[model samples]
Target: MKNSSRRRVRPASIASLRRVHSHGGTNNQKQRSLSTGRIGFFALLFVALYWVKLGFGGSLSTSSKAANSLGSSAPRRNRAHLSYDAEEQVAKHKLLPEEAQIIRTARSLSPVTYDKVAMSFFVMYGRFLLPFYERRPDMKVLNIGLGCEEDISARLLRKLLPKANLWEAEERVTCVGSEIEGLHSLTGDQGDVQVLDSWIEKSGGMFDVIIDDGKRHHNCQVLTSFEKLWPQLTPGGLYFFEDLHLGKSDDHRSYSTPACDGSSFVFSDHIKNWLDDIIYQGGYNSKKWELHYVFCQAGGCAVAKEPPGTIYNKPPSPNQFDKKQMLPGEYHFVTTAETFDPVTDKVTTHSFFTMYGRFLLPYYQRKPRMKMLEIGLGCDMNYGPGASVSLWKNLFPSAELWEAEYDGECVEKAVKEGKLDGLNPLVGDQGNNATLDSWIEKSGGQFDVVIDDGGHHNCQIKASFDKLWPQLLPGGLYFIEDISGKSKPEHLIDCVWPILCTHDLHHSGQVEGL
Candidate 1:
């Protein structure tokens, strides 16, 4: 516990786990707080924008002098003297060398906060946005909420990344099709995903940078934008959520869903919970979604999407799982299908290697003598005994594998027929805690990998995970497949979510991907 990097779960009490609820205020009190919050929020925004507009030191006319005042440590640029070509480029709204210098200077300044209000989103610009644009010059950007007539942040973005296409969405902005310089305008409610999707379709590409500055008071709007648009963002893209200060002053009340205590939904608390759930559901262990980097400040938060493996230039691993091509595991799976028909017999291909070949390959390769435990042995009449065990043996020839099945007669039959030769078998009910404990004891108290290809019932799965997951070695994998067959809603929301949430709570909401 002292070293946060090491995660060890105590499985005994996992069943009785509970989520601590966050409480807020009544509707009228919340509305009053929101009003006060909004006023302060805009005041800070005005100050930040006004500071940038005045060129940091004060007057826009003396911008070059202001840039020089930042000290010689700042990037050198001649802002006042511009060549004929440079002036024309400036008139065209292209990023000039001088403008880029000023933008960098603005972002590098120390963050300024007052009364717990943090206003400098430029910190994120320097940390994430700048490097990204530098890498992809013609990047597409989506900026929601065009504040005031000037819209300073959008304007700065356009000036900084001149070649980049900038899309601005605001409910009040009337020009939907109008394009000024590189900035495209789309007028609509920021909460509406369809409105943004239409613009994305028209643009013929996804965005590299997305900033949500609109609808600061609504958590549901933020959630909707993230869920619908995150997939639309290019991998390695940056997404920024600004003005989190509203959550502090507005008592974190959401306009839509009520909090668990019957008050309005707590925006800050709930969004974090949702994000933690996202990390658990699509973590590094899974093949689909990946969150590469997550950083949060008092004012805002930023999430970066990790690029896919296929995008890498490296050659594919021979053991990599590909449904299109027959992998070693897949080949063994098909060859072993004579015991049971995959289609007509209606037996799911519950082979451990077939189901988790991609994830298990690297671990198996690293430790050829790795120990593995599988909760179910596919002992039904349709499946035939030890089918998965056979596939696992073929794929992981050197692995010490153990298959736990409820039917003792099935294990006896497989052993008698030489189907489970050189395999460790534990015959018992998977739902019993004592049975799970005994299995752990018999097959060594630790494992590099544990798979639940078992009963597919909620009770059995929960029992196995609760007992085995804690016993899994550090950096080990615990895979649960065919969960859709029979997991109860209550079990997931109560037991699974809490366990995952607890494991992640120690991790500070960040799941580092492989």
Candidate 2:
């Protein structure tokens, strides 16, 4: 029943072997051998059946059932290493009208065939890019790779954005590499940072959109190129790196050449780390270009830089607040009567709150339970500290209101006088990140509206906006009051102009107004 030597035997052939006592052996021994053979045969049969059930060894019915379990109607291709489920990802995201038009335009470009469906790079363009182009039809665009045959991206941008200043950088313009007619073509290897820097110098201005469709397998080149070229991208600009799947895994090292080390650094890992640092370090707090968004998918990744300032355009609600609802009511002034009207009941108020009310009141009907954060407590003269807080509470009683002031004593005094009831004010400096973080933590992390009415100094106003703008909820309102009285004129021009002037040139669909 057992062999002394560890020799292999096929499961099918095991049954054909001679029984231990079958060759004229005793009856008892023969009977035992027969029993063992029968047991071994049944054991082999069970394993074969189990293998068939698992859709192995040509079990068509079982294989079909296994395929159906994956929730795909079409036959599945081997996509084991992909970062996303193709069908599921495609199903959830619908292309916008402008995005769809971008794909159609790319496909219409002759000779070079693009991916027909979910695999199209132009689809990604439509999702992340169309907004910028739609906002600024005359924006500058740079495509890094001009294909040997027809250049789809170059041709497509030329067709869709007729007024856009389009440029293409080709490694070679030999017989194989054909240059397009309308776009500005620069000859240089994109792997060289000098080449990219020179392109910037020759182009004369910063690009609003940059596409890297060159040398997909060169990981180090891509990273180095990004570092050099990023500074040249305009504020609120976008940079797209295509064919990321090529360098997403370690095995891609096989594709590396002597000049490029693909596996020495992973492109996706670097992008992820950069994004994490940008968020954790309050990167937007600086005036320098900072990462706003990093979107990675199965094919490639797109990075968007933060603008110096944010311009939000809250949509006009059909059920807007009436004049009576937004009108400022009576407040107990420390100097005047105990209860006197600020605006509607009497014309004795010195404030811009009435003007701001027109733009702010619509939010009440939009989000009745909206949360608002104001940087200044205004707790000094007359109706000190929590004075503005009282106004907000009166306007949107159902909303969660918060105020941050530099003076803790002013807040304590306001509370002692029963000025701040049903509220907990934050006492900290707006210029400090620690104070901003403390306010963020105490106020449930995010806000629907942020008002900078604090010091009104250049640095104070900028720091508050940079730190808080990222935390503001989508479609949220961010207001910087008294810009005409900034600490320095250059501060307003250098910092405020980019945020306000570019209102008509980026994310314009959701941008209702400046």
Candidate 3:
């Protein structure tokens, strides 16, 4: 708001940019036709589907500033030949040193956009990084693996960006890295997949830069986790994947075994699988992560994500959400303390989990007498009592708390402990299709909120979703906690999260974790 002048564009340039963006382009791809021997019908269908998805996803030709993507069919360096010498490229680009540095590394690359004019694809980290880098602190960062004792990158970032605000909540930066023990002790948490995921989930929001060098061998897990982490990151964030060449040749992890010629990722390839799964794909993730630039220098790769716009990166409000109303039950509910205490009704929940409570409280509070379904009831009866049953009982005194617990004894225990007031419990295997269907049938398939705090396993999570999501009412919320891999909440069929985040500048309803 301080300087609207900076955003101003000349009318002619605006029109030109729009024209360039609107132009549809077909990539000059090598494999225009698949080499299907005799039967080409299926192959034709496959080709048609591929193009259709591309059209849905967007193409380099028509994408905003996409003429420079590695996959673009732009006629600049490729104005014809798929090769470029430094001098020739310099002459062709009439470039600066920084621009020349990019050209040098991008010469032999394919499936990338090429528009030296827009500098879209195959870009260097240093070029785009500093331009967008802030000196202030509070920028949360996650650097995996970099296994350096000195933490040279973190130190260098500190020096490049101004540090006058690191101490203030609005100014400080928090960078957490985790890795295996090496000659240099990494300051990060140990590079365990689930542990890192927990840390990311606990961080409660996305990072500005996520550098993953966690594994030298098998990187499939790392990339898989990135799916969850990337959504957490602010739009236009930078992501780095160290040692991309390992995917091409490293046998320790069998990263990739197919021929290394210019082509797409073959099956079972880690790095390529990552690219294939995310980029050029259609989904909320793809819509958010347009490739700004990429560089494969010294066998390592650094990529910049396209700006997601100001909307996705809105910061949490200055005033915290009032938790007094959503209290003691909220505490015992979150902590999993088997017994609920009415005397300590004024218990305070931690800010970390309260973020979830903030957005969730408003959902159920509207209807005091609402139907709440929670899958994966914690604590077995032979051992202990459950949390959600008691929490919901106290939190929503007038509403009914529906639970889907897998064990018979747990339900029996709850019945004995006098914990069954307003609590409707279902005892069945959460992972079983029959059980889920039976539960839906019994409940008449209606719930105001569906919370999956149950089996965090991928298959079980998805199975519960497939069966139970349909039961949730419109404008309802479905939450999956402790999820480490791909769980596309937005991609869920017919599930609409009406208020993902409120526009109330002071009170944003940020969905804490997926």
Candidate 4:
């Protein structure tokens, strides 16, 4: 008892592990928080949009007089406009003594709030854009109508190239129509340019880079007027069009389902036509400024005027997935295996849904025998012959299939035609309780998989997922084909977070986890 041996010390409690170094891993209670944060993101998205809709009206009014020249007369070979004092404002932050001291102290402590709302997009923008800023001394930047539409693009550019002068346009009037405001607005029609010439004249010189995000309605005008903008750009500048998901400024909630009845994608058709006609219009010499590099995503696109300088010796890296993998099924459905028209099918579906299939293929391949449901029979006639329903049926033969569409007659025809082995379509609102109850009762009260390729409206997405996802068999997957700019309901996790933060452990509303 008197002998002193080294004692094993249990230094901390289980609660201490939970408290220290919080915010990562299983020990953190953040799973509950993240689950609620799901609801919070939707709250934030709707709040962000609602707040933007109600208050974010932008008009570009400047105190300076309108200049007829766009700094394109000739390249400046001198330091005539450079000032050390102005450069010190940003390049060398001459913060006041008190502010500098505060900043030094702030570096050692954890931030009270991480209100980094803009960091996500800024990270994405900078990924492909930093190279442009690096070569700025030899560049002239023109941001067409970026005045108020996307102030961040200009702000980012300014930060990236502090010394460079950038010319941006203020919307004075609608580009094509008799609309009072020059700002982009939601309208039934994609407005034509009525006063585009005025803005072009007022802008003065040509630009090396043009961002055509001025007004949503004027996308057509900007594409057609590339002849005007391209001349302004340096021999190898770029043209960017942001917020391409929205067809117009006014509409925030609809997307093109690219089934190609007759009309083409509004922006796609317009831009392609312009690209084809650019040679006839002139100034875009094919050999000199190759219209070579075009980059597009869910959000927008960037078209480069083949680089005159800074050539990369190495080829780009290989991609992880091929875009055309899902196209075969999509093509077969759209073409009815009849026309052999892969080109039209590719244009109609694009690669948007392929991303969903890419992620879901694993879950699907593993569970080929699970019961499945496909909502929204495309407008293929209203009786409900949706391409997704057809594709899923082919993908999973043994699995039972169910289809829902608003049009009962279309569903009846498909059922009569023995589509998916005579499985009669479940025709009703995908969001309705009665319809869901009837379907659940009819299909033994559960589905192993649910794919929401439905109306794609915000309300419909929320309603269908909220009401039905819990009915999914545990360990099953729910695949939703989401539009890039639009929010998906169950993205936070497979489960939609209960609005009430705390609930009874066994409440009837509670569902099994994914």
Candidate 5:
């Protein structure tokens, strides 16, 4: 019977017989039976184990491997597929060129390659928080120091919160400190604080955000933080202190050591004492303020707020103040006419108003129907792009634009050129309150945007603000360009603080009483 069955059974495939022989088969019949039973048992065990794993939520190696393969495949799938809608959106927003450039720059200067990890981290922090701030148009911002020529923070804020007003103050050193070169040129003339204060008081509002990016003098930090900064901040506004490591005395002395000349002014010990006094003694009210002392990899960060004070507090004196009058030589060039270069046919390099007018045209295109005003248009609005009357007409075709050129020649030239179509070029000096009042009256006291690119002098800015801020509609935006002059220790203490304090008062009152 076995022989007959064997004859009827098809011969085992070579592969199956090899496996059976490898198992050390006793006899052909026995080997077949044993092999079948063993295979069945192992299959049953595998099935049971797999069922157990699935039922108990355990992940098997094979399953994990399969998941990883899927994960790898996803990115490949995404790359293979292109969304036309995304491309269209990019093109429609005109975002590709700038966005790509920004991305390329960011990748090249990535934190991994950058040596200053702490600064990188802070920058990331600012980037992370910026979007939230951007959504709130009413939120005010203050940037204390204009660190380095390329201020990353300022650039970020400008891009993110294009409409939000940012008050940026940098400490001006009479002579550049040895620790950092190329800062002397950026310093504002001495006594700029007084001008800054005058401008702020005149402007009639306070900053929503404040940043300290100036020299790391303990006295400056203390005074600016406690007196100038805190008092000026709008309720719920933010103040950021950058390069806090400079606040250390040890580092201060080291910085001073490299100075061969007497121009070096080291204030590390003074900074330490000031910080110690505030931190230890609760110099800033604990109840009114929420202190965030973030010891980040980049540097020390301190965020503080007043409890419930009106923004109208008296301006605190900055520890350092310079009283020297600015000379015309200090101002590289002052233009009273909107002259064009014969070679390039572009506005002369020194023409501020012309540059402003040109810059504003494209911006106006992006945000159409927005009302804008140029304060202190010395000679045909020449600080930023919209300063040129011709540029302004082309930029805001459908919107109302106004230019306050103090000089008659530029205003008449702008009118003659037919560049002042929608622009109401008023003859007035920002220095004189009556002139500003008359100009505002002529324009009807309502503007959505105000640019104080005029009068790089601090006091002129203050005067313009006093005359113009009331005319700014609620949720309107204002800009004070070229305030690079507040770097002097004296100007910071005297002028800038006072103006900031006055604005604080206005902002506080608007928040509370209004």
Candidate 6:
């Protein structure tokens, strides 16, 4: 059967089988292809595993570092040395112990170290009024409302005019002994205008310096004091009334009753009467006494002088009495724009929503040629026309400026324009580390005035004061606007009192604590 099968297999079929298995090529090619596929698969698996491990490990390490970093507290700026330097500068002024004591007391009352409004008034008055008294040794100074003797005004007066006698009036009679020395107190019915008149009459003739720091009985005080004190004032003397807002109160009838005496009237109506009389008749009819209204935030002061040619005789000229002169290179102007934009070549003026600008101008103008540094440059044009470099060129014509700003673009634009010549427009945040120091260093540490208008935050205001106070010139002025919003008299007593007291400067008995 095997022989028969072999015989049946054709020669052609045997030849094809031999040819198919010629060199074992098909089996080798198949084996090689399978091996290549296995190698590729293993390589891909290894790469995938390695990638997963690396990604997971990296994520864990990153998270751990982030947690550690976040857990740490930020370091505080080292201001100890700066504070010491400030203390030393104050010491150089060698302020008296009594003055220093008042300042300390004021500072202890609040967290802030300075009172911008009171301080501004004190400095300005000291600059202008003190000199007048200094030139005349026998000027009788009367402080009307002696709420508390621990103030800058009282201290400054004592220092500036050591020979001039000071008389202070209080609502209640208390011990005459205080830091101010010879403190005489008086008591009267509430809003009694006669009490002031009685005191003035008893003290003989008028005074050289009459300050109305009395109670806020606007109508009574105005009527009683205007008739009595104006005639008593020495020619060219000044009369300042505190708390003018009392005049605008609606309760005019409440100020005086039959039992309380007829000391009250419509205070606002009286002021309006005076204003109207001035407009229509070219002057008010206070028996020939010329009335000039001096408005301030704390209050308004009225100055009444007999006719220029009256028997009392006015000073050479109202301007002559004012020794204010424009500083070289100092100029000022009032523009409708709040800020100048170089790119658009436009001036954007801030709307007058309040009387801050109006009051600020007179205060600044009183100084004449003081060097000034304003933080809120365009918000309020308190410095007047020649206040900036552009306008100052025409006004002062020779003042220098060093302006630091947080907006780089604004600073760059201001510099590119000719509006700010000789002004160093420093670009950086006022709160940034070393930024204030850099500006101070660049400015050569000379400034007569410093206005904090940049950041109104309490911390920023305090920090700015801490940094800038040392740079201020002795007897120079520093203005911090918008303080009426959050600032109380106590805050200024705390921060500024210490520094001021250290220099033997004190408040004018205006504020209570200091």
Number of the predicted model whose TM-score against the real structure is largest: 2
Better of 3 and 6 by lDDT: 3
How far residue 492's Cα lies from its native spot in candidate 1, in Å, is 14
lDDT of 4 by residue, 1-514 (tens): 0012212133232224324423211110001122232222222211111111111011100100000111112212122212112223223322122222222232222321011111111212332343344434435565554434334434444544455556555454343232222222222121233344444465555566666655433334444445445666664566776544444332421322223221223453344333322212121223433553344432345666644431222221112122222222222222322122111111232222222322233234445566777777665522224444444444455677777777787666656555435343676776566776777776674676676666644345555665665566543445544322132233222333343222112112111100
Residue 181, model 2: Cα distance from true site in angstroms: 3.8
* Model 3 ranges with Cα > 4 A deviation: 1-355, 381-383, 485-514
Tell me the deviation in Å of residue 268 in model 2: 0.9
- Candidate 2 residue pairs in clash (backbone atoms < 3 Å): 379-384, 379-385
- Reference-based lDDT, each prediction: 0.49, 0.50, 0.41, 0.39, 0.37, 0.39
Model 4 segments more than 4 A misplaced: 1-347, 380-384, 420-424, 482-514
The best-first sequence of candidates by lDDT reads: 2, 1, 3, 6, 4, 5
Model 2 segments beyond 4 Å from truth? 1-93, 116-120, 175-179, 249-261, 286-289, 310-514
List where candidate 6 sits over 4 angstroms from the true fold.
1-128, 148-161, 175-179, 182-194, 216-218, 247-253, 257-269, 272-287, 292-295, 302-395, 399-514
The candidate with the higher TM-score, 1 or 5, is: 1
Candidate 6 TM-score to native: 0.38
lDDT of 1 by residue, 1-514 (tens): 0112222222211112111111100000001111221111111111122122221221222432232122212222333222213234334433223433444443333321111111334445544565566556788888877653445556566666788988887777553443357777777665566766776687664788888877444665666667667888886678888765454343333344222331344345544443432333323333344554355543566777755442222222323323222233233333333333222111132222323432354346546688898877777746355545655665577888888889898788777777677788898988777888788788876787777767755556656655775666644556665432332333232234322311111223222111
TM-score of 1: 0.42
Q: Count the backbone clashes (under 3 Å) in each candidate.
A: 0, 2, 20, 16, 68, 42
Q: lDDT by residue for model 2 over 1-514, one digit each (tens)? A: 0112112222211112113212110000001111121111111111111112221112223232333222213322322212233333333332234445654565456743353223334444755576456456678988777665556556766777788888887777572344555578777766676777788789974889888877443567677668778887887688998765556445444444345566576665566455333322222232344765455433556777754443112322322212211112111111111122221111122223322432354345446688888777775535334445544655567888887888898787777766667666888889777898888888875687777777755556656665776676644556654432332333332324222211112111211111
Q: Which numbered prediction scores highest in lDDT against the true structure?
A: 2
Candidate 6, position 217, lDDT: 49
User: TM-scores of all models?
Assistant: 0.42, 0.43, 0.33, 0.32, 0.30, 0.38
Backbone clashes in model 1:
0
2 versus 5: better TM-score goes to: 2
- Which ten residues in a row are the worst by lDDT in model 6? 24-33
Worst 10 residues of 4 by lDDT: 59-68
